[model samples]
Target chain A: MIKRTISSIALALGLAVATIPALASEGEGLAPAGTNIRDQASLQRGAKLFFNYCVGCHSLKYVRYSRLASDLGLSEEEVMTNLNFTGAKFGEPVISHMPADDAKTWFGKDPPDLSLEARAKGVDFIFNYLNSFYLDPTRPVGWNNTVFPNASMPNPLWELQGLQTAVHGEAAPGQEAVVEKLQISTPGRMSPEEFRGATRDLTAFLEYAAEPAALERQSIGVWVILFLAGLTFLLYLLKHEYWKDVHESH
Target chain B: MANVFSRIGDWVNERAPNLAPTYRKHMTEYFAPKNFNLWYYFGSLALLVLVNQIVTGIFLTMNYKTSALEAFNSVEYIMRDVEWGWLIRYMHSTGASLFFVVVFLHMFRGIMYGSFKRPRELVWILGMLIFLVLMAEAFMGYVLPWGNMSFWGAKVIISLFGTIPYIGGSLVEWIMGDFLPADATLNRFFALHVIALPLVLLLLVVLHLAALHEVGSNNPDGVDVKHGPKGNKWNPEKPIDAIPFHPYYTVKDLVGVGFFLTIAAFIIFFAPTFGGWFLEHDNFTPANNLVTPSHIKPSWYFTPFYAILRMIPSFFGTAIWGVIGMFGAILLLALLPWIDKGEVRSVRYRGLGFRIALGVLVFSFLALGLVGAGVTAEVIPEWFPGADVTTWENAFGRLMVLGYFGFFVFVWVYTRFGFEKTKPVPERVTMHD
Candidate 1:
């Protein structure tokens, strides 16, 4: 009886383990479908959004002002005068305006660096999340997110994008449903389409900021692969020529 | 004119086959039975987890400062200031634990199926190397936040290497490149943990998979397939044996990858730092060498070994023994094929001795792990009269340590003399038809 119990338990455990791989294959979230985010113009707009909105709270500490200026085709003087804070030089990093302790105390969370934000949370997630914010007065920030719940940070771009609320209602029997459509309660500077475009640019900029080398690396990779392929072809031809004489002689 | 056009078409077809073989040929060529079911997925999952770690880690490193003063603050900066920085940090931190879980499963699979057997020795050895490198990576990564546990945990683990006879002190110094696990050690380890070791791991993983594909896979049955279908009772049809790697394995892997990500995401977004084991409260405190943390422990993965190490009495020699036992556990696995001499590969046909030995081995490990976590009972008080330790507790601890070592010896003996010789093979076979 003990042996049978043990065998049964083992079999059950084995079946569970076997099912893991099958169950694992579902719902890849928020990575854009079939889109390569390599357009230079898109990256440029993304940089502009990052500087205007994101730099106030989040710092790209690893990225120097000079590097950003050169990469994004901005003048060092423009970067220093417009974007630079914390009395940092042109070669210095984009440090946050808020002190760590104070930020933590005020927001109940410290603001993180934006440098690698894009690489960490893919561009689509950022894009969708920025647009997903809806009003919730109960939360610490007076704002809630569909993508991220109970977010401590308020919608910083609310002035430009305007206040939008989600309408909640019940679904039919045996269904789980909560539908949300943005209804502007208060108007801001930009229209909805324009606001979305701005957010897209911001997300793109953050993505570029996260891995500034990605664009260069990808382009370089293409050339390198091409060169290697050509070399392989040459080697193959050489092998054929060399082997032909041996086969004929034999 | 029609014949010339047809000839041209035929020429294109002949060359096209070379460029891209028919689905059937391609399937036969590459999709040949990995025969690998559960165990095979973990390595690939480990790779996916590694990539996740790297991506998340790079972002965290961007904002993270290694300086003693700013290290803790910078990490906080990432959580708050950077847009979605919190998400990235959680993903990377959670990924470190997940990496170990997958690798452990992968290594255990290697053991259970005798994937480490003879010709595939290099695969197992490389895996051990990867495991060691992973440990180092996790250790270095823990120290990056410069939290309370990070500082003291490094101190304790580093202190372990200081147990050798004459050159012990020097060896520790050499390993750290300093007197202690200080700023220089953190910096170099950060470099190694992020860049150097990952590259090596990637290369080793590729080699590990290549070796696996070459040998096909050892199933739970463990039958050698070289002797044709007559020797083995089960035979997978040629078409089933040959599935295209691109669509079939790729889709399968993607599904597995998706599921792994979902679990990881749920943990990262929902419940990062599930209390004591995942994220210790003390780790939130900044690193302070002046003040030693109370009851410093390594991450959950290392707890079992750490528990074993602490069970030893001497503060000095105990550390050395811990290191030996940890490495010995892995090194012993490399020699398992030679150690177990049963002619039949499957555990199904194995004798009572093997089963009992396996059970005991598992139990001993679990007991050692429990003791390592410092779960001691106060049953008897006479073991150390002067000291604050109880007799039963002390004896239990010592017994578990012995049991841990005894498992290897038990398996070695059982495989040598306890098993019977195989009987003659059955000739007749019945098919489903």
Candidate 2:
């Protein structure tokens, strides 16, 4: 019974460990964002895009300008010169210039801070939501999202990605038509491939903004594991040496 | 140098003479059974995790805001602005989950080795009290972050108290100090999580170790080491199969600590969220009382009991039955030392009836954990297309709950009657490589 129990436990533990990486990539039937925070160039590009487009109404309130400067390999001067459009200090968080009342008047609700959006909803949700925007006359805003159904705000980067229209599926007797696919009606500044890459970069930046420690965590984790492994090996030797008395006793 | 240290030690010892003897009693002279196996690692590991929690908790409290409005942002502040604050926060969060993991394994070891039997029953009772207190601590600590899940989870759990017969509604209101889990609830939970419960937990741990030492440690063989052949290297009165805890087990436990810390560090650094099990995704959002999370569940550790509460149907227009069943499940486990009446201490010498009974209990517990975590809810629909998910889940979950309680009844009847066959009892502890 003991042996069987131990083996069963071992099997359970093994299965759990195997599922960790698989779970990290889980998303809700959306195209994978495939964002890498380690890619400094992509993160920098995403940071620029966020400041130029998203930062007018939305804020990354938990993210500091100095942190962006350091993690994205840009200098304080560079960040202030290019990305600090709100006239905040270098150490202050990235707040939008738009007032909450003004935002509520414009969008019918205040746009939420995007500081933890990539975490609350995964990077894939952000990427797919950005890409899923389509022109809809039925909504209060001129745009609608297939991923989010009826989001309050219009597409902040609509000019860059151009105008998209929904391809509706066949409706049942009393049901509304489902968005089967999204098609670009008019091309914007960037082509289909470029827009995808741009969205991917923006997704990567938001992912980093969500947890800035992630960049440092992965690098430091390697060294921490190595040090503990060394300590464990030495302790194993010491334990082995001390247990000889018990082995020799009988 | 040695002479000066000895004189300093002597001066302190003269002032507090019992301290040296007490230290010797628990450390250098305490004789633990030499045949202890892999399961023995968890007790010391649990102590290590407790220290981890306390130290990290202190640092977290230094920056953590107690109000509902600032609590979420303060945690983010800790992660972003404070120097090495992310590490401290991760350690505490990871430590909370790992504490339950280590403790559950420790309790399982006690059951497997029959360490809760006979003279060690007080030790088991003290340990159970610690377990109960730890659950309260973990639940309260989880709500301190003031995330959407934390707010909803607190509201859901505190409302469970509202199922009492007469004062249920008032009781919940009293517990929360408001109609809902608001600033008042957060403040009180912070106080209890930080100050009150930890003190109780510490006292229980000391008493548990004291009681265990009074009766001595139990081994895998479940043979009474004190009743065996006498005379070891240091003490003639001690059993032949016993060894001092200081150099033997202390060094042994050190190795276990090293290995345990390695895994802990891996999780803390690489996967602090443990794929949303340790930290839920919805918890990233600040608490909004107006909007609740789409899919709300408690932490993974509470799922089995949570599943039980959901599985049992409420009767007589009151949900109190499910509440009673949830609390009853934990009560029955705590009453295990008195439940099994079998004379055999080790499963090695126990009959097939007891073995099967224990097997049923373990299997059912794991299955119920799955049900509680909503793993079966997602999987059942995928595995059997067009199946009614609620009906299927409830049927499977209800059976598992029965098996969970039935183990207690089965073991008691099987042993109370002379249905159990016996094997020859060993005179001394036996070691396996």
Candidate 3:
């Protein structure tokens, strides 16, 4: 009967483990994100870049500027001097002064707030999107993306990445030219490898923005498991003393 | 100090003579059959899990936000800012999953030994009521996170009420307290999850134990140790086959609890989400009313019935029948005490037909659950994975759902003809070896 119960427990545990199944990735053109959320230095650099460029248009409504000090390991004074652009208070949400209605009319739509964007679109999607922009003659901004077709926003990092041109394949009959590949027509100050690293940093920062506790959770988890192990050993000895009769009789 | 404690004890004893007697009756003197098996461990463990949930749940409410707008961020806040909040949240979430696992095994024990058989019918009924309340409690609690899955899972379930022809739309509106599931829905669910269902659940659990104590425990042998002719058969004052639950079973139960906690710690600390089984990845994203996820699955515990709900073709015109089918799967368990016509109690005494049916039922139920978790989730889910069995999955799902119902029918058939076969019931308790 103990064997039956043991086997049953094993079977249930097996089934419980089976429950998650493997996850299938969603979304297209999502190049694998090569960023680690644990990379604090990269995240700090990403915050600097975000303050310089993305904050002028896109706002991170959910993040607090104050949180960056503790999370990204920046000093409050450093954050104020380096990253604070709108002269806001330390505890304020990362909001931009650009009015939504005016920006919407100017750009065909207001630049969406990016508080939950990293989570909404995965890290891979954001990473690839940063690298996918290219020049298109017919578009309003003279820019387009293979990742996101006819994107209204011009290349936000075009200067750092330089201008990219889509090399097209021969058209089939009346069809439009298929962009077979991308080429950097004009090189920016940063090399392709450097730009990739920069984008990786940005992706890491966004990933942390999505779940700031990701790094600490697993580390703290080790101690929690250890504590439970100690408790189990204490309980087991007490239980052993009580079960002396049952084992002897059986 | 001893004299003072004795005076207080005397004062309590004078006020209530039944206190010590009741304690002795239920705890010290309760005569459980000595040959009880490892399957008996879960009943107390279930109680332990229940206590863990209630305690952790109370702490969670201190920090949790009940509004849909703030709920998602608030969970993250708890996970991040609150002291040891992640640990508490994990314990609660993991406790919910463990609660079902513990209860299911306890239920299986009852089935194996026919604990639901004669003289203990009320205990079974009360237990069944507790199970129903637990489902409701879990359902309400699942929505409190207010993530994409929580919002949409609640939406899909509440929309089931809207399937009721004329009053359906109004019923759903009234339940939601708005046009759709939003702040009002989250708030109401919060109240019910924390207060109403738990209140009823505690009461039912109490009743379940009280009723169980009145009849004493059924053992693996399914023999009544309480009654028999003294000296000639078995003692009436104290059955020779029975042992006191306190020193014997209490210690045994503690060991079970230790094992349970070890497994629970493994889940809570290491895999809090249980790899998307306990917590879905979609739930990490905040709820969006405008966009629907391509695939929506219920929490792992509820998936078996959800699969049944989806498997039924809605050719009967309205979806009301499918809704009925989903609920009927659970409601059928309440009838188990009366459904089986078998004279014998233990599965050991039952013929092969009954065992075969029991085996199939377990298989079908598990198959349905595995399928519902998203077909063959055990395998890696790549789009072009070679094991893709999209069509086969649908067919397999349909068959398993049918087999779930067929098991009960098979029970009705086997009980009619099958006669008991077992080694003679010993007058004194005997070990299997």
Candidate 4:
């Protein structure tokens, strides 16, 4: 009976632990980003893409160029010559040259800094948002996203991924057409598979930008945990040795 | 080298004559119950985590910017620019979460073995005060980050004061020093979090340990070792079933600390955010007064009480009752010593009713935490298709709330009406490896 009671209590506690993470999820079916921050090659590719395409409007204000160079395994000269477009100092953060006031006038909102976007919204959300842009005649920017509908900014990577038009499902009377899927109307320089990979690389870079220490912490953690486990084993032996007195007396 | 150390020790002992004796009284000479089980590890572990929080918090504050405008960016600066700052910051965050983890388990042990009965009531009361102050400290420390969740969480919690009858609006404004949580609030919270509350927590912890040492520890079997058959090797007056706390428990607690730090290091290094439970994802964004998060809930530690506040419906044109229910939940736990008035201390000897009631309380507390976290809101629709989500949540949540409060009532009735059929307790503490 006592054993039964303990099992029941454990079951209840397990149920409680299992339920809390359910809040972290959303109903929207986001595609997997398949991005790895650990891949230096992927991160380098992402950095190149971000500098070329996204840096025109968005900023990575928290990510410093010097730190980026070190983390991405690039020399200062290579990063400065190839990736640094705005002539920012090596120690300076990646701030866009596009004036905030101008951005506000053009887009009706200032394009947000993308430094912490990957942290705020998961990498999957960024990947899907980048992929979901479609041509829309009614939108002011002539572009709309299915992931983040009515987004103000036009597709910045339109040259690479090409133009997409929404395949609308049947709508009821007086209702707007529901987007079933995005169909590529105009293919760009890259193939469909290549574009997806490019977007994943960009997402991976942003993820790294969000928390640069992720590259270091995991490596350091292994040694720390190993040391602690060893110490715990030794302490357990000492505790057992000391407890002999109590056991002997008993 | 030994002679020099002895001389220095003697010098200090001459100035402070009670030092060595006090150490002996608390450590080497102090006798603890021999049969302390796994539940006993949490007390020492809580102390270890407290030290971790204090040490890490000091390093964090050295670089942390307290003002609302600078705080969020400054945290990022620390994460990126400051050398090894991410480790310190993660340790503090992970320590804060783990503090509650160990403390909750410690409190559960107290309840399970009846550590708060009679002689140890003062110890329990002091512990409850520590819990209260620790909650305040944590809330203030959270707001110092100036993250979006921090801003909104501060607003929602402080607005609980707005449920006051007449002074509601003014009290909230007085607390924030503004209409909303802003620079003034952040500065004040930083002051309280760093300086004022930690001092109180430290004082209460010292007093709690002093009180426990005075009364001696309660064992798993709940036998009063002091009054049992006496006479040990150390002293004729000492309980036979007791051992010196230093060599025995000191070594034992070292093992516990090692295991604990292993888990803590795992969290601080690899999974510092604990998948948004420890350091929330919304908190990554800078605070914006213009927009509110879609979901605003307190940290996981506060969720059970937050659920209690939510589950208690507004009555008589006032939401004050809900606020009352929230505070009352904690107040009830603090008053456990009085509510559970029985000769039989441990659950091992306690009647079946007591056991079932305590189990229900544990289940309810954990379930209520899930409710407060807004998990049920997301889950109810998925589980029961076409169901009125709010209605389903409210019904289930309110029942859990009842179960939480009902434990105190049921225990009172069971003990008062002699419904308890306590087994005969052993004169000596039953020992096991």
Candidate 5:
């Protein structure tokens, strides 16, 4: 009875655990963010973009600019020259000098620290939200978002994304101004595809920023699981040897 | 090396009198049926995780901030500033989920084998108490983080006490020790999480073991090994086909431990957040008093009960039925030994009604857990027909809440009334299929 139940349960447990990876939080018209946190080059591009644009308002206070340098395969000199817009020290956190009160006055609210934003709002949400921005003349920021409606922050990458006009259709009969999609009217230096790649890279960087050790830990976890597998093999042999006496004697 | 260990043992025995005897009784000579199998592993695996949680928890407490102001930052500080603190934090956080997973499995093993029957009733009761304390400990530990979920989850859960009509408001205020969930609640929860609950857990674990040891084990066959006659002179004290736990089960459990650690390490290192099941996405943000997140889902472990809590319609004076249903759900599990009246202990020999009931119960529990975690049931669409998604979802949830309680009620009814032929249990532990 014990043997049958155990074998059955172990089999079921294996199948149940196998299903977890498939449980991606897919919903609505949200695009899949295939973020590759281990891709250092993509992460580097993301870091560059984040520091250049987002840092003017938002901050990554948990992350050291110097640590970012090493993790993204850049030297202190290169980081100092390129990404250090606000003149932060190499060892200091990636915080901008823009004061909160002043920023609040400008944007109607202080832009939250993006240190844990990727984790808090999720990578897909961030990836989608950035791309969901559209032109809305009546709004204070002159922009609205499909992902986050009435967001206070303007489309900071509007120059690259150009002007996106919101195409609307009724979800039901009475609903007005329900956006169906976005279309770029006047394109900027970067095309839509290039902007998507940039956002993906930014998403990847935020994924890394949320937990910088994720890439390293994922790499090390393979070895750790493998080592445990080795120990499991040895113990299996030991168990079979011990159980031999009981089986033969019986 | 062997002689030196014996000498040290003898030296210790001289001072500590009967140390060897105690060790023999608890470890070396403790005998169990040779037919014990995989599910037996989780008992020891649970112990392994408890040790991991306690050790990791102690280290975390050394650095953890008790006040709401620094709690979120303190976690970040530990993650970044302290050496290997990220690993420790992941281990503890990840271990909390793993602990429940293993405990749930262990309890399932009990249900599968009827380990809660007859002479083992006290063991079941003690195990139930341990589970209760464990839930409290996990809740308090979660609050220590002071994240969005931490603060709000505490507020929402503690506010359940306020459902008591006359005394409810004061009780919640007393529990929080302030107008809302603030530093005082955080500090008190910290004390209980670190100091009080762990002591209860330790005591209950000891008692659980003692009760089980006294009763020997209920094997998969649901037969007591100590029945009939003792074994031959070569193995005089133990019953037929029984083996010592130390060399046999200990080694067997070690392989299980290896597998468990493999799974745990994978999560802790690769997906500690487990895509927001083990660690919720909302927990990444510091607690904000003014704004609540769009949705407040409990951790995956609590989802089933959380579902039960939500199943009750507000028309039943809002909170009263939900609170009653939530507590009663757990209380049913605790009272199962007396409630279940099946002639046979193991499900292997249980009646047809029992088999079907068990299947539904497991399904309902898992379905409820998923639904609780904001996963909609696919079956609901087919059954409900015309209603909007959320309405159907709530209706399905209500149906599940009914099935969940109906399972316990069925156990009580089936055990008392159902008739089924019992399988002829063997006298000795036999390996042959």
Candidate 6:
């Protein structure tokens, strides 16, 4: 009886363990593997979007103007004249004009730095979030986010992306009321396709900025592994040559 | 035409087989138990989760700033401005907690099956090392946000190190590279958390797996199969005993991983701040050194040990005792194989004394954890202020602490001499064929 019970417990535990993978498969959100962040064109476009739109509230303090100019194939003068804000030098980082205290008072949360933003969040999330803005009157910013609810900051990209109101239907028996879809009441500066393209460029840029070395590293990694594999093959041949006579005798 | 293709395929096959004969030999000869149940999947799943964490973490570090003024905002910037930054951040944070959950279950499985016995001692030791590295990783990762909890949590944990006799304060400073856990510590920790420690963990994991593979896995029945027939080792061969890891185990793990993600996603996407615990309400606020959080607690994983530390009476000595006890529990696990001396492999054959002793240890741990979580204070009468200082909430705290350590001592003693010998299993009694 004891033996039966112990074995049964072990069996039960094993079965319980098997259930984990099934759970993982559900709600596997749409994040495809591999990101095309290394393309210079993508990076250039991303940088442009970042400078024009994101830099107003966000900062990239670790990234120097000099580095950006050289890496992106821009002249120092071009970077200084175009990207550099008031009172900034060629060597300085792109610091936000907004004070931290002022930002907190305005947004109820300080606007975060954009230096590592792409690296910290993936390109897909940024793309989705940028397009997820909806109108909410209760919020301090006169807007809420589907991606991040109760967000303190107003949809800064509202003019370009346009206005959207959430359409909610009645709740099911146990379920809460759901957002059926977002209805665009008014159009913004850019068309839907144009807005998407802009966000995609921004996402691509942040992705590049987050890991500027990723593209180079991945390409370099492939060659390194291949070289090592080739070396191993040569070594194997040498071993065979040395052991040829001994193996025949055996 | 068909004959020509077949001939070519056969020629390729014969030459290929001879060139890598050892590969084929291993494919056929390598024998894992056919009856390996769901419990066996965790180790591999853990590896998968670890890789996910490292990959996601590396990307996050690319954009993450270590400065006090910018750290919090940098994280927000990642969420708002950086493309797909939210996904990477969520995956990493969720993965960290999941890593612990899986490891805890894996360790519990080890305890259930007596996998930490004799010959497998090194594997257990390596596991303990991995656990230590994981704790360090989690602690460091928590500080990256530089929120109120991040600042105070670091302060509380680092101060514990200051309780050591002579040079403790200096040691803490040396670790931090400053007077307090400041920008220097955050920058260094970012490097270590993202790079150095993960490399160590990877090496240890390889060693741990290599050791387990060498000894083969232990089953619920703790018996050694070293002397059994070469083909009929461990247990009798059964159809369920052997299944391909790729599809069979992969599918199982996928299911488990899916379930875990659903729960984690719900928390991350919807109820990120469940009560005040998951993402502490105050942590939403930026770091402020002047103010102390009302009830500062480490993430849930460390709460049990943190509670144990609080139970101690002396300010300085309390911290010392806490560190010692935490390390001691882990160190003792490495020694379990040597301590247990039962003749039978299965718990079924083990004596009642051994079973009861094991039960007591489990109960005591749970009790200590409960007391650590503020239960003991509420239950114990307030009149005994002396008890609060002397014991954790007076007499109750003292008794529970004693019970915690006492259980370990008792298990070592009980396993050493308490079990009785038993006859070999009868042919009819053997379940495996």
Q: Rate the local accuracy (lDDT) of all candidates.
A: 0.66, 0.90, 0.81, 0.90, 0.84, 0.66
Q: What ranges in model 3 sit over 4 Å off?
A: A19-21, A24-35, A106-155, A162-193, B35-38, B227-236, B376-391, B419-433
**Docking quality (DockQ) for each candidate:** 0.02, 0.62, 0.35, 0.62, 0.56, 0.02
Query: Least accurate stretch of 10 residues (summed lDDT) in model 6 chain B?
Result: B424-433
How close to the true structure is residue A39 of candidate 6, measured as C-alpha lDDT? 62
DockQ, computed on Cα atoms, for candidate 5: 0.56
Pairs clashing within candidate 4: none
Chain A vs. true chain A, TM-score per candidate? Answer: 0.80, 0.93, 0.88, 0.93, 0.91, 0.80
| Candidate 5 colliding pairs | B341-B415
Tens-digit per-residue lDDT, A50-114, candidate 3: 88879998887767889888888889999999999899889987898899898988788888777
DockQ of 4: 0.62
Clashes of each: 14, 0, 1, 0, 1, 42
lDDT (Cα, tens digit) per residue for candidate 6, span B1-433: 9999989878987878674444432333334443344455577778878988989888888888888878987886675446667667866876776687678768866766677776677898899899989999999998889988788899988888887889888989998898877889889888888889999999999899778767766655554444343333222551223322333344455555554455555544533333333445446556788877655778756665776676656654245776777667666766677666554555545666656666666555656654554545544544455455435454665566666667567667766666444446322212231
Instruction: Tell me the spans in candidate 2 whose CA falls farther than 4 Å from its real position.
Output: A1-6, A15-26
TM-score of 6: 0.58
If both were scored by DockQ, which would come out higher, candidate 4 or candidate 5? 4
lDDT of 2 by residue, A71-152 (tens): 9999999999999998999999999888899888888999899999998988998999999899999999888998898999
What digit string (tens of lDDT, one per residue) describes model 1 on residues B1-433? 9999989878987878664454434333454332445455677789889889878888887888877778877886776457667668877888888898788777766666566776677777778878887888898888888887798888888878777668888888987778766788778877888789888878887777777666655544455543333211122442232233544455455555655665665555444654344555567666778777656778867865775676666655345776776667666766677776666554445666666666666566655554554434321233345555545555777777677667567767766785444433322211110
Model 5 CA deviation exceeding 4 Å by range: A1-23, A170-174, B1-4, B232-234, B314-318, B377-386, B418-421
Q: Summarize candidate 5's per-residue lDDT along B1-433 as a digit string, tens digits.
A: 9999999978988899987787888777887877776678889999999999999999998888888899999998888767788999999999999999889989988987899988899999999999999999999899888999998899899988988889999999999999999999999999999989999999999999988888788777777778846883237867866778888788888889888898899889878888677788788999998879667777778988989988777665557788889889889998988888776877766777777878888777877887777766443554567658688788888888888899898878767665544676666555542
> RMSD (Cα, Å) of candidate 2?
1.6
